[model samples]
Target: MTKLQPYEKRPYRPGVGMLLVNDGDLVFVGRRIDQRAEAWQMPQGGIDEGEDARTAAMRELEEEIGTAKAEIVAESRDWIYYDLPPDIADKVWKGQYRGQKQKWFLLRFRGQDSDIRLDTKHQEFDAWRWVPLDQVPALIVPFKQVLYRKVVQEFAPLLARA
Candidate 1:
């Protein structure tokens, strides 16, 4: 048997993130209710046991934005991973995970702006807006910038056709 690297010892949380795009090709981003800084992110959440990534993505959208009026356009070919900053790693997930390995879905929003709601029962975001894809990296927290960039790159072609 091969030895496990230190980083490999800590499990990554399984999660899903949605890149919901309007007819204008602008992506949806939300201002995190828990964050005081200018931190904004796409809808994302942990996948529960026995839940498929796509189902989890839909559930997260309903849970976070209070709507499921979107259809999947494409899914990331591979899982994208991000490590939380050390300061917050131990604080999140009850210290069980170092970060997340997420399957991202690109979705086309079929609903109007009024269909988007931020006051879900579990409200994760306080405010939200549709933004150009390029601006996404700069809008998110520093630790997640790289992951956001990769997601943007992976979906740019499909987004261009949107």
Candidate 2:
């Protein structure tokens, strides 16, 4: 009989995040449907059992933003991690994970803005917009600001040539 670790000692949830960039070099962000404050984020979600991170990223992008019309430009050299605030750690992910370890993909958008649909069967966002890469860190929740900044920094060069 194995015992479970405390949530604080639990492993981070494995996840995938997408940095969808337009031809103009702006990144896509969406206002969270679950948050009341002005919190926005790039498309991201958990990796399903047996699914690879790249597949999960594309699936999450379509599920969250209703479009997968993007091509991968680059992948982060290493996984990035962030911890959930103590107050919310036990509330999210059924108290199983303390945070997320994410593989981020830089994808170039291949469709027009009109192609982005938010009214998916399971909607994650209420509104969406394109913003410069540097503005991403400020648009997300405070807890995720550092993660966003790291993502931006990692992908900035690829985004410039994209």
Candidate 3:
């Protein structure tokens, strides 16, 4: 018997993101570099080789926000997915992998807010800010708003526990 890989038949694979929260408030929302005014999203990135979803989540959190995984206080158990907008999908990702299937995590900030730094090496985000949980949908890119809503709704219980 042999195991089959989904994307082995395709050109790309779906990635995940962690929507970290702290005391019911989401972490720093970012403005992407290419489309500064048009893009706003939770910290996220691609899953690496041999990396588990949780490991990718933790790595992305630190790489994007400069905060270590030890700083997170909570995370969601399930995942939320959203497809890419056809307009820029080919230009950016160039794939038939559908889109990102993110595992939204509700992290409680265990470290100081000052730990956030947008510029690492490559500069994934240009600017960021801590916003209220209710504001995430309106602040994210319009196409991604639907996923934001889903992620929030699915993780609503975690907020109540904060």
Cα RMSDs, all models: 4.0, 2.1, 5.3
Q: Among all windows of ten consecutive residues in candidate 2, which has the lowest summed lDDT?
A: 1-10
Q: Supply candidate 1's per-residue lDDT for 149.
A: 98
For each candidate in turn, the TM-score is 0.94, 0.95, 0.81
Q: Candidate 2 versus the native: TM-score?
A: 0.95
RMSD of 1: 4.0
> How close to the true structure is residue 121 of candidate 3, measured as C-alpha lDDT?
73
Give the Å shift of residue 143 in candidate 1: 0.5
Query: lDDT per model, in order?
Result: 0.92, 0.91, 0.69
Residue clash pairs of candidate 2: none
CA shift of 160, model 3, Å: 3.4
* 83-127: candidate 1 lDDT, tens digit per residue: 987658767776677899999999999999999999999999999
**Cα distance off (Å), candidate 2, residue 116:** 0.4
**Over 4 Å off in model 3, which ranges?**
1-12, 23-26, 69-77
- lDDT ranking from best candidate downward: 1, 2, 3
Question: Across residues 1-162, which tens digit of lDDT does each residue of candidate 2 receive?
Answer: 344458678899999999999999998999999997989999999999999999999999999988899999899999999999876887887777889999999999999899999999999999999999899999999999999999999899887787
What C-alpha lDDT does candidate 1 achieve relative to the native structure? Answer: 0.92
